[model samples]
Target: MRRFVYCKVVLTTSLVWVLVDVFLLLYFSECNKCDDRKDRSLLPALRAVMSRTHEGPGEMGKAVIIPKEDQEKMKELFKINQFNLMASDMIALNRSLPDVRLDGCKTKVYPDDLPNTSIVIVFHNEAWSTLLRTVHSVINRSPRHLLVEILLVDDASERGRGNFMKLRGAAASRGQVITFLDAHCECTVGWLEPLLARIKEDRKAVVCPIIDVISDETFEYMAGSDMTYGGFNWKLNFRWYPVPQREMDRRKGDRTLPVRTPTMAGGLFSIDRSYFEEIGTYDPGMDIWGGENLEMSFRIWQCGGSLEIVTCSHVGHVFRKATPYSFPGGTGQVINKNNRRLAEVWMDEFKDFFYIISPGVVRVDYGDVSARKALREALQCKPFSWYLENIYPDSQIPRRYYSLGEIRNVETNQCVDNMGRKENEKVGFFNCHGMGGNQVFSYTADKEIRTDDLCLDVSRLNGPVVMLKCHHMKGNQMFEYDAERLTLLHVNSNQCLDMPSEEDKMVPTLRDCNGSRSQQWLLRNMTLSM
Candidate 1:
């Protein structure tokens, strides 16, 4: 019997140990799986880590990551794809509007005009039809003599090298001075106009023409949606909210209202040349292109000058399907670095918003921490409140209002007898209106219920008026008689306790007491003048 008992104890101990080992193994396996998911999710962080170590390599470093052969193939494929999309979209747009004239109307120019206006177009590898149509449209509508120069900045196009040079030469010979700026690195569009426009417009204010995009095949105006042109949210995310109906109705006859935006879409815009020079043009230190729009937009807004979308002017650009070239194997990292630079300079406290939206992404700290310090020093010209209220008014969103009737039933109970009931009577009743979620409250003959005391309990009301809890006090809680409307008014505020707005007041009787937030009252701060 003793041997059997010892054997049983050993068996029980073995079973417990086996269970422990299995649980640990399963837990460790799950942990490994979780680690794998985290690694995949943290691509942006991984890229950022890689960028810090890989800076000195420059463009070559980017190319070195991918095999040279793969890079070339990718470049070729991307170019082909972009060209195909542009060609198709352009063709479709043209077919849709076959009779669309390059010049709908012509403006006569006096010899004194002397070509004061300069049109600058920046493009990478654009389609022939799209590019030609843009030039043709400008030449046809603009006064021939006032058109001083057409600067075409060729952003290092790989495919249409010969054609682009030829077009530049032709425009130059036609009495339009054409200058092509070749950049070996990435370049953004819409930087040239603000500089040129600033030069023309008193050399003080910086401005750009409203920009629109052309459909790839149809050549129809594709962009300029109220939503897309409204700039971006803090997360570097873009959204276009529909114009309110009231505002739209007001704008029916006129479309030239000055729109204040946080940032301009980097497409086609014009700036005065003199003002452009004053603000130092584009930051020469910036890599070939990319993020220049953000830099220019923020600098313009921060440094006293304002940017606006002029409704009268419109310029169309071709939208590409994808980037034709990547920086070797590290295109994603390169772009991340470029955006980081802008975020660091302009975002300040809002920089964290970007990181939260795009986690694990690494960006180059473009404006050093001191850039923010410099911005602070430079921005001493205007109050931040002025900027928020006048310059960037879109930041303030209005509170939304919903009708009380839509949200709750406001029927009154004819069955309940209240002739002798006291103000603080506690009574349970069924809601006849079947609006189950609203609050119900009541006021007594000697005392009136303050808005704060109105409890939002839905179960106590017999009818639509939600039975809410209310504090009843002598003299302060009762309503004054209104001879004209037969309505009750609170003696404290002299406000008709159950009246709606003037538009809704014309009805014979109040259907439901509208409970607007404005109607709620606080009695402690009140001064009651009998």
Candidate 2:
């Protein structure tokens, strides 16, 4: 009986130990697997292509070549992940405003005296102080009779429709056209006036207003920073500056000169009503506010219209915090995906600049797809060069500098200027061309002695000739070389020298020693003035 009992106890002990070993192996395996997955998911280097040709299905009747491997990868990558499909809860919006009245202000009517201006204010959860100030400022400063309408476009606010109604009633009773547009999206101020004013102006100008920033917490006024002001750089990169010059001047007084920008902020602007609808107002496909400005800005600029900021007009707005809640399954990704679509479509050649500026942030794949479609449908317009040359003639091109090749040691025959020259003087100049055939010419005097190299003892030419004294051998010897026309020009005489037909000729012979018409070259300065 004792032996049987002992055998049962031993069996139970062995079974418990086996189970413990199995559990430990399973946990260890899972941990290793997790680490492996993480290692595989590292970020890739940002490599993007700016192809001249658009990628899409080939023309009708043409055989379309689709790579099987790429097709499979696309299918797998695009498979809807249920876990990623999540939406953010709606944000609470502020709708209350302090009771502020513009007393003794005469209200104006429309029809007989239509307003030369209609200020469209769009708000989500704006603070009371700023909103009222914006309204009051317009009422106080604007010509009462000429002020046509104050249209407030409201993105559905938790402040309730009642508040908007009361605000609307107050303005209406004053004999001003006060209309409320209820929406749950944000728009740039730039969209407002240009659209309304342009519609009023020509029934063809699709204009949008500039978006300015306002604060909610302090109810303090802040305008859009230059960082948010989008414009094209020399490289054709669409860049954002923090603030506009006008806003900066408001605080510091106008120190800046007026300049042209490719695109204005969409926060607070005006446009004509008729043209807004004609050109198809805001893109309907865009979700509740984000990149609508970019879409509108590009559409207006590309489609036979222009955008500008009225220097005299100003409005204040509140810049808000980022959304806390996300859409179901991460639809915000879709919104981002849409932005790239808009950029690709409008920016085209300059789209690569976006990636170069913000690497790893913008997904190039999806944007390329959308841009390709837009490019195919878009009406071919003038090249960017044409716009640079004609629309903005004053725009400056940066100076280009290059080094002069090896110079052979040559003995100086004569020194006209009394400056002394020591032995072994390095003589070279920048061999480069400038905008409008101008070239950079520079030369350096010897270290120990100062001597000016002159020909025929003539320091000044009576005819149309400008002499430039330069230091640094390469700098003074530098003349302009026109790669386009294959001409070498002297900076002083502005004359092209005749080079031997052989490509390897070192020095070209000038047609005339005297400043003749053929020798005189037209010099144009292209330095950026602003």
Candidate 3:
């Protein structure tokens, strides 16, 4: 009986081993099929890991190079956005950027209870990678508790009024402060603290960031100069000029101190929520985006507020050569209309300077500015002259001038024209157009024959009349207009401005003071503001 029980146990054990072997073979076959599917599906994720590991294109703010085979395709895609779309696509959305701040800024500390901000980003059909990158950079860099939320505004309405769109964003915000940033920008490390800290100290302070350059072609990040600030030309166009010596002295040569700028680029800034509403958020009547920056700047300064550029804050912006979006009527027409509204409401008598610089604006229908004028009056704002005198003492616009009109040569019947040239370029003479623009010249109390920010300067005996930046210093730039003789005499060289000859390349020249008609000139539409 014992032998029979042993035989049965052996047979059962053999059967159990065979079943286990069959089960193992089936499981191995299914796992091989699953492995094949995962290889195909996870290829993109694996590449992403490799890219991060190897430091991919545009990593660390470096420029991205396009392969030879992709050059033509890149060119074609560039037109769609007026930027290097192909290169932007190759960059990771959360790409790393260098810490491009001053050494002092790196160690700066902020209050733990700093005011939280609701960032307002406005865009109209921007590229996917750039837009996402902007959002990601902001999220990654800004302190979570300090950032309430980001409101992405779609200003792509048929009217496409950027001012109105921003107003909507400001209205919807729930944070203590409202920060406006452009759609194609990257926030650098510690960019938010300095801005909010300033506002927390002074609610009426509207602060801006030092905007760095992000190359539109190579997708490379570049640091902009810390020595520049925003200013406006006579035509109300925004410009960047070097920080003056007076401002540097005020800061005591500290690179980390906030810069007191006359105007802002209007793209990236932060303001207290209640203060924004109290001072009037923005001109709803303004169209699209053109003169809003200057409008806000003037209103802020005149209405008991300060505009500043915090030096410790740095943000990268993509500077495109041309805009990709279309203007409703025409680009020039829309901008002219917007400028006219701001000039009429905020510029006071100085509006004449804008009208004279851009005569075409005289004909544009700027809609009704009665409401804007009412806002200024309600705020009991200071006059434009006060702004120029107290805030922007170095303004290009002369407070006191003998003449504000055209300078025409009697013999040639041509006007002394700027010809849209820059500083140090030869001054040209064009047929009198009667309309202001390049023909306008201002003989200031300082005795400088100026056009816009340029002065008629000639140091050599018979050198080509050149346009030097009005130095306010009375040396080569000093000129005396002999109203009796109708001659313009360069005081330093004692030479008169003569009409250009054929060999002069249409550029005016300086000659010994002669009473001849070639040296005689007249000021058309001249008005005395002295």
Model 2: how far residue 432 lies from native, Å: 34
Candidate 3 residues 149-187, lDDT tens each?
777666645557677778888887778999999989999
- TM-score: the better of candidates 1 and 3: 3
lDDT scores of the candidates, listed in order: 0.38, 0.34, 0.83
Number of backbone collisions per candidate: 52, 84, 0
TM-scores of all candidate predictions against the true structure? 0.45, 0.37, 0.89
Tens-digit lDDT string for candidate 2 (194-249): 23333444444433323333332223333432223355433233445444444455
For every candidate structure, what is the RMSD over all alpha carbons to the true structure, in angstroms?
A: 24.4, 24.6, 14.8
Displacement of residue 80 (Cα, Å) in model 1 is: 1.8
Alpha carbon lDDT of residue 161, candidate 2?
A: 32
Residue 168 displacement in candidate 2 (angstroms): 18
Give RMSD (Å) of candidate 2 vs. truth.
24.6
lDDT of 1 at 246: 42
What's model 2's lDDT at 87?
11
